[model samples]
Target chain A: MTASDDFAWEPLDDVDDLEVGDRRELSLASGKLVLVMRTETGLHASCADCPHQDTPLAEGMLDGSVLTCPLHFWQWDVTTGEPLGVAELPLEIFELKQEDGRWWIGMRR
Target chain B: MIEVTVEDRAGGRTRFAARPGERLLHAGLAAGLGLPYECATGTCGSCRATVTEGDVGSLWADAPGRRVCRRPGEILMCQSAAAGGALSLKLPTAFRDRREPECRSLSGRLSSFRRFTAEIGTFSVELDEPVEHLPGQFALISAPGVEGPRAYSMTGNPSTEPRLDFLARLSGPGKLTPRLFSNALEGREVEVFGPLGRAALRPEDDRPFVAIAGGSGVAGMLSIVEAALARGHFDRHPSRLVFGLRSMEGSYLLDRLSEFVRLSGGLFRTTVAFSDEAPDPEFEAIFPDLEFTTGYVHDVVRSGLSSISADRPICFVAGPPPMVDATMRMLVVEGKVSPAEIRFDRFG
Candidate 1:
């Protein structure tokens, strides 16, 4: 594993607990972040607060790969971390993986 | 010099210097900081920030954004100036780690003034240099002698040249419109600062577009539609535009809208909704290709929601606050559309 002082791989929760197209807020030791969407494609994670105006992303609307910020309607591609129309910046994406039927997130040190 | 320290929610800090009598938002943006703002003229509360440990002064104390700032330390960054010493503040939003188009001040001259009605007019500004702005973006224009600048959306397509078109609606006498409409004001120099506003059309958006505008609010929509047509967006995805007016006399831009519809080759749909009066026979005769309905604009949109697909659809709404609010509520609550799917610019 590549060593980095900024990030670490931390187990989040059981993969079976999260349903497809549903997002859950996970409180890790590092900080509060949102585990956005388990689709047939894969799992993804991003900051809980929106990059625009700091609205909670947990309150945002998620449709498949697109996550829409509730505050300003700024849309993001959850998988690629690309901002869509009206969104100026991409959402910070965390590395996510599944092992032993449990999900893990890359948390910033 | 005033030292402004802004702390974001994620604990990121940005320090900048602000000159005396400079708006905090302006100074921050000039320094290439991603400060939150929407109507830099003190209308929208998007730029509200909290002063943690310093005194701040206001250029416009009674700004509309004040009503939305409920917290004790909260102040509209657009209206607030650092009065003295080092100022520490907290932002609800954080600056992103990305490159953004540089926004700067531009000088221009007013030309091509044509009155559409007693309450409405269309005009053009010839800039000293061409500006790059997205469709649905707006510019802030200040008349030579005016005390404050007003935000006006650029009408028609985004231009690569120095010329820009605008639609102006007279709220009443004794404002910027009077000065602009004056006969002697032609060819007068004006100061412009912008390429502002985020409710814009992106080239990458492939979803069907629905535009809802009221009166002068249609200004930005015209630019959006024009850009959409140029991109052949209508050819792939359908577009529906609904414009609302009080009566036929107050109506303008029907011919331009008709032209857009004709160019879309049956892919674009448009409707004119009149709130107070029924459609006149003579008005229908002029634009035979357009559809006319009698009702409030939001109601027309609500009634027609069934025909529009919700899958990845992008909707834009602009108008007076009440109309925009009503339309937003209908789209969110009644229509069950995701709030993210709807975009709006509310003029109070």
Candidate 2:
């Protein structure tokens, strides 16, 4: 709704309820699910399921900057998608931008 | 004898020989290959790998860990064995070569038993060979006629005694717990694979500690506390523990906890949290060292989390699935504790 908004930034819905240390799975138009978490550093988004066993990361616990899967307790830094101890795979993280008082999520540049 | 070949995603290949009836996971581990695993009793599915060449025999046909095998040839290494001749498998992760064997088979027999409550009891297993173990580790014990191994935390200090002791609670509907309470189980030979798990008590760390447990999960907590007390760790650092139970009738091991408190000279504190009922006056008079509270175990842990010293205390937790999950959430989210500092075997 604004001029010079030519970037393909997809508007994110249900972001108003995202609080610090909270995550929710969002259904994308592409039928892909992405888990969005708000930490002290701001908003972060990653693949909804864990790479190890495909457990839903939305059901996991996020402590500060790390997200721990409930099933096996595999941990990762949600902000950077870096695998933590006992985690063999890195998470695919999407970039989130809050611009013009609105939130958007897209592929990492 | 069977030949097993393993290939990992990191372009690493290794060949090893496995004795007949030996599990693939155990064989690899005993050979000093660092295969990633948790809850090695055909649970957690951390050792899922693909069979690219030959078929492997299934020990437990209905292992719950099979739920994680989605790919065409994926199988839980812990539950599979070399059926015959040669077998080739591939893992999705890299292998780290380690020096010490992660676990070894121990043929043990039921030596003694002591009842703590109607459903809870303590049993001792005398292994044919002595195996040194760290505190807070658990074993995967398979009894005769039991379809598969069940994980139990070792309650006895293995350093002092060669035999292993386990606290058993006969929760409704179990594969092996009912047999643990039977008098016929005495002298029964069983299979044990253990001294596994990483949440061990390191007395040298010299940091304050906290333990939260529910039901029979106190088995590991007791091991850690006893080990810490033996090394005089409590004299240098303060520690906290909370054990959860349904009511006074379900409670046991208070005498040992009381003894631990008395030996600590008040440095180590324990609180018993009852979910169903508060302790009566008569019960309260029995152990003056224990503090009794009425609430869920997770809340009890939360109430004391803020009071713990800020010098980075390692937290140990164990329980039924729901209690462990809820308590972990409380520690990481509400208590602001790091996930790295909290340790427990999922048994999931």
Q: lDDT at B35 for candidate 2?
A: 79
Q: What is the lDDT of residue B205 in candidate 2?
A: 68
Candidate 1 lDDT over residue span B1-348, tens digit each: 899999986788989899988778877876778777877888777898889998999888888668757778989998889999999989876665423355677899999989888878888889999988888888888887777678788997877789888888777323677776665568989887777776689767888889999888999999999999999999899888999999988788899999999999968989999999999888898998799989999999999777654554788999887788778767764666766577688765
- In model 2, where do residues sit more than 4 Å from their true spots? A1-22, A27-30, A38-43, A63-66, A84-86, A95-109, B7-13, B93-102
Lowest lDDT sum, 10 consecutive residues, model 2 chain B, at B93-102
Query: What does candidate 1 score on TM?
Result: 0.74
Provide TM-scores for the models. 0.74, 0.87
- TM-score of candidate 2's chain B against its reference? 0.92
For each candidate, what is the lDDT?
0.81, 0.82
- lDDT per residue (tens digit) for residues B1-348 in model 2: 798999987778998889878889989887767876778877678789999998788997788878888879999999998888899999877785453325788898986788889988989888887777778888888888877777788986656455898888777446787877876688999988877777678545678888888888889889999988888888888898898999998789999999999999999999999999988989989999999999889999887777643556888888887898898878776776666688775544
Q: Cα lDDT for residue B131, model 2? A: 77
lDDT, residue B229, model 1:
94
